[model samples]
Target: MSDETMRWAPAVPAANHPGGALRRWASGWWSVVHLVLHPLALALHVTALVLLVTGTALVPVLGIGFLLLVPARLLVAAGAHLERYRLAAVLGVHVPASGPCPVTGAWWRQLVLDPRPWRRAGHLALVSTFGVIGAGVVLALAGTGLAALAAPAVSAGLGHAGEYSWPFGIPGTLHAPALLVAAAGVLLLALTPPVARAFTAVEVLTARALLGPGRGEREAVLRRRVETLTETRSRTVDSVEAERRRIERDLHDGPQQRLVSLAMQLGMAKRALDRGGPDAAREFLDAASSSASAAISDMRHVARGIHPPVLTDRGLDAAVSALAAASPVPVDVEVLLPAGGRPSPTAEAIAYFCVSEALTNTAKHARASRAVVQLWHEAAPGAGLLRLRVSDDGVGGAAPAGGSVADGGSGLRGLGDRLAAVDGWLHLDSPPGGPTVLEAAVPWTVGGDR
Candidate 1:
């Protein structure tokens, strides 16, 4: 589909208006229960942080302080992780995990330089305070409501009307104080959900802001993407140029020469006919016919090299099946695409080429007796991806650019570049002397008719 037609629109949540007493009461009770646990969880978080900080300080003096620090930071991170899940569960707000931690450099250097750890620590500290306050407020509201609800029972048991007072000097009543207190209790209970929601929102927002991917990590991701794109762009340009040269060479050596010969034979036949030599003209015409057929066959082969007609006509499934059928060795093909679900033309073409190239490499170099090609669509929230896996039981010492395959040219690397053009990637797993698996994934969304 066109980008304009597939523009994204934000989804707004429908507001809940309590339509029944039962719903209000249940919501209030749920708030009271969760609010009671919120404080406990926060208290635990605070205690863990305190211990973590203290342990780090003491261990540093003992020369093992750095070792303790790493685990301490991890503990802090673990607590923050749990809090993120808790926020999602209790508050219905999802906070995704922070991006991967940098593990390449010295552990101490990475930990010290990375800001996420410190941000998580800060969140732990603040959540403790927020949790305490929320717990206190919820408990006070629930406790007061419960106390008011029990006033009538207490008064009846004592055989005398109990005195009850409302907030802000609303005045206590000895006569029918039970009714007044119960009414107050019901009011308090009704207000608890909104009040608890307000308090919980603070913690949820804090976790989302502090416990998720920070600005630094996001920028780092973008920078890496830029580098990848630059490399892929260069490779794509080189690949296109190499392909053009290849096609030129094919035409020069194959179809173009054949057509030239065919024209020469036709000229010779015309001359023989002019000389009234029927037998010589007939021989020349026969040769010319053979040359023309060879030329047509050579042109068809070149065209197939550019793009297989089957791929355009029948989609990825049929294209891949044709590839498997043509392989020198046995190939097992499995294609799992949903009915009525088709990837964009570009995606399908890329997938077909990747499989074709990989299978060619397998058949030519792997010396394997058999191979397998699997294709499937993976669906996600906003988009889908086409996943292809080609594996062969061949002598597995293949690298993208070097090794034995170096003589075979940079076909694998070119495939990677092709996939990268579509925001896809290629992964190669070829160990010393065993199976070699090539997997590629490309983003694809259902588009307008083929």
Candidate 2:
């Protein structure tokens, strides 16, 4: 499949809405309101957090002159997270609970030496800058409302500085100005959230600079890793299919053609003997029989190496049992899987080869009396994992030979490559003693037609 198709799969699943209670609950204006509010809450929380972080750095300067206020300074620094959480909830952001800031093992020494705390002190110095702006807007609205309500009362004292008016206060000569100021205050109050939101965005950007390892960057890195693994898996499957094609071509052209020619030659030899002496006939018959037997053995070996039919006809459970029955030593088979569902043809073949190679290694190297093969599907949190394990009661030491299994010692490298093609893994667990085990895990329904 193309990358676009793969990307679309998850979205289809996500778009499928759940039924019953969930559908009923989500089918209202409240849900829409909640959706809109959540982002606002997040912005508020992030902004407050930034302000708090900026304020924290100022503690050091104050501490230098008044070291006694260190405890109070620490409390003020911690209050940033607390206030962030509060704003998050009010805005409907799903914020997590937090305890004290994590302290490294050498926190006390680091606190004194690190530049971040000092930077935080600088941020803290600007705390009043934000506060003053926020407070100025709130107080301006309050003053205007008060002036509007008490317009008549403040008419005679219009030139006086301390006198204020409100819409519902005592009758005032300057009612018009007071009413206008109150109207302006009401408008400012209504506009505060959006203005605050924009300010918070700036604060979050600043906090990320001061706090280190911004959340967005962390999440982006994680996403990149997931994409890498997915693409790697896809490439691995493509390579495996390419290899199987190569092997099939090799067998069809080489051993298969040679066997057919040999059979034809034997047939011609028998016809010649029928026209000759009894002695000649017997010799030709014997030679032909021997040639036929050898060809049959060679063909069987090649066929088994390519793709064993037993694995396909009976699935992994029966195929493994047949393998154990064929082993030189007494072998056992234990299968623990669902009655059987067909995996992709490529996956099944790879699974069989993994088990066969493992057993072949054990029989050749490990001097064991008995062996066990187990097949099962491993159900994990998000994906279906199929596993096969081959164990032998033999000498444990088996490693890659001369760097390649083609040199004919242990088949580790070849087997590893084969497993990789089908998005599978082989793990060798052998300590230098009496028993060794090889485990294989293959992902199902990927690459080719499933």
Candidate number with greatest TM-score? 1
Write one digit per residue (lDDT tens) for candidate 1, span 181-272: 78999888677777887776676677778998887777898999999889888988988888899899999999999999999999999999
Assess candidate 1 and give its lDDT. 0.77
Name the lDDT of candidate 2: 0.57
TM-score of 2: 0.48
The per-residue C-alpha lDDT of model 1 at residue 363 equals 84
Candidate 1: stretches off by over 4 Å: 1-44, 52-72, 83-114, 125-208, 277-280, 379-382, 400-408, 445-450
Q: Model 2 Cα displacement at 337 (Å)?
A: 1.9
Cα deviation at 67, candidate 1, in Å, is 9.8
After TM-score superposition, what is the CA distance of residue 351 in candidate 1 from its true location, in Å? 1.8
